[model samples]
Target: MASSWDNRVAFVVRYLYDIDCNGYLDAHDFHCLALRSCVLEGKGECSKARLQKYQHIMLSLWEEIAQLADFDKDGIVTVDEFKQAVMNCCVGRRYEDFPQAMRAFIESNFRLIDLNNDGILALEEYRYDCVQRIVVEDIKIIDEAYYSLLNDDDRRRGGITLTRYQELFAQFLGDQSDDCPAKHLFGPLEL
Candidate 1:
């Protein structure tokens, strides 16, 4: 059986690496990164300062994710490499205590998912990006219950901050739910 910590770590890693939203880590996500780099490179008519800022951010993120996922040192990460890298990362750390590089990857992906840049993940955003992909009915039920556990104001506001996300995952440590909602975020576990 997957331990509670295992489930949480897997959830966070899934949130970071599953960029194409097809429910698996693969080269397509890398292609998406490359395409973004191209956009930054070709932002000719856009403001130079804005383009430069985005370019630098994209380069940094590309470097970090490529370094982690590209295990064969072949300049690309295969599906196996992606899974191995995620499994190896933050092994000694708890759910919310991801290393700086891992945290950066999470934040980078979170920025992509947050769409409006409002510093929060609205309900629909979270539902579409993370929840809807999960197939198990019981797990979805758990997700709904956990989401309801958020503060009334945050629930009403339509989303939670990144800190609030981490907090909720941590809260799962004490929760006696048969299956964790956080785990469902990544889809069904093998256990």
Candidate 2:
């Protein structure tokens, strides 16, 4: 009953979000909010104040991203719903297209990476805080994918402004193919 494009979307979605290596994209990918608790406990390199900010930002990202597959609004994306969302995207019903959904996801991610809240993200922030934070074995691929979203001149500029970040994010979410470097975040792709 599924078309080739739908299958491709499913494959890409699985390849990009199955953080547990268990072929599923559920709330577990958010790591049970341990990162939040760690920050609250001052258990990381960032100061309590900075981590506090990250806590809110990360939570928002988790909620928005998870909602993409939470068809029933139950706060969890069952494997079935996850597959359905991918199929839906193939038909031009992308969850990322929703303004509120995309805004919340992007804003939270930018805020989390922009620890200084200076409205700009330094290269270190993009490389370490943003890319490194991804729970994947081959971070190099994620790094490549992220940088690929920017122009060479932009990369050379040494930092990304909020506007540039939005552009990069749009490119990232718009591409759903296996070669879309951002797909490396969940791990390597088989197709």
Candidate 3:
């Protein structure tokens, strides 16, 4: 009974990971490789430092989505596993904390995580989801802060570059944006 339940539960979690996460067999599995490549690969060189920084961003993004994970087999919370943390977060269309198994997510997560039984999760796979999520989230937050003719028109025009995104933050969010740098929205990540 125990082994059967474990298998079933693990299967469902994998299903959910495929939907939201980069669809690795499991989110934890993805992190396992990302940590090694991004952090472990760093050395006493400029590239090494650059890689580590990217790793940090991936970790942060993972942390954000992980708030919705489910760990306990009882469909309840009792531990602090990353899976449990992820299931606890806000994801999906409405950002609602819907309590569903991993198998439930059938949305187009192909661009984010693919569940093709691929054994390894590359840096690109890991970072793309993180960066894209960060961009969308940042845009939402920015739009909430300001909606002037110039501000609203620029984003609509699509002429605004990533470099100018920082200026947008400084202009509207102002001091609230102080704690976070504009570069965080999107920057070249090599790891």
Q: Give TM-scores for every candidate, taking all chains together and pairing residue i with residue i.
A: 0.52, 0.51, 0.25
Clashing residue pairs, backbone N/CA/C < 3 A, model 1: none
lDDT of the structure predicted as candidate 2:
0.52
Superposed by TM-score, candidate 3 places the C-alpha of residue 86 at a distance from the truth, in angstroms, of 9.4
Q: Which ten residues in a row have the lowest lDDT in candidate 2?
A: 181-190
Model 3 ranges with Cα > 4 A deviation: 1-46, 71-152, 155-191
Select the stronger candidate by TM-score from 2 and 3: 2
Candidate 1: misplaced stretches above 4 Å?
A: 1-31, 34-51, 92-101, 115-117, 128-158, 166-181, 186-191
Superior candidate under TM-score, 1 versus 3? 1
Q: Candidate 2 on 1-191: residue-level lDDT in tens?
A: 12233343454345334545565555565553435434533435547566555455445545666766777886667557765654454233333464464455455656657767787776556666534334546657656645555566566765577667665444344444435433322223333
Question: RMSD for each model, in Å, please?
Answer: 6.5, 6.4, 16.1
* Model 1 agreement with the true structure over 97-186: per-residue lDDT tens digits: 644544554455456557677888765566555453444555465456446545776777767777766555444432434454444333
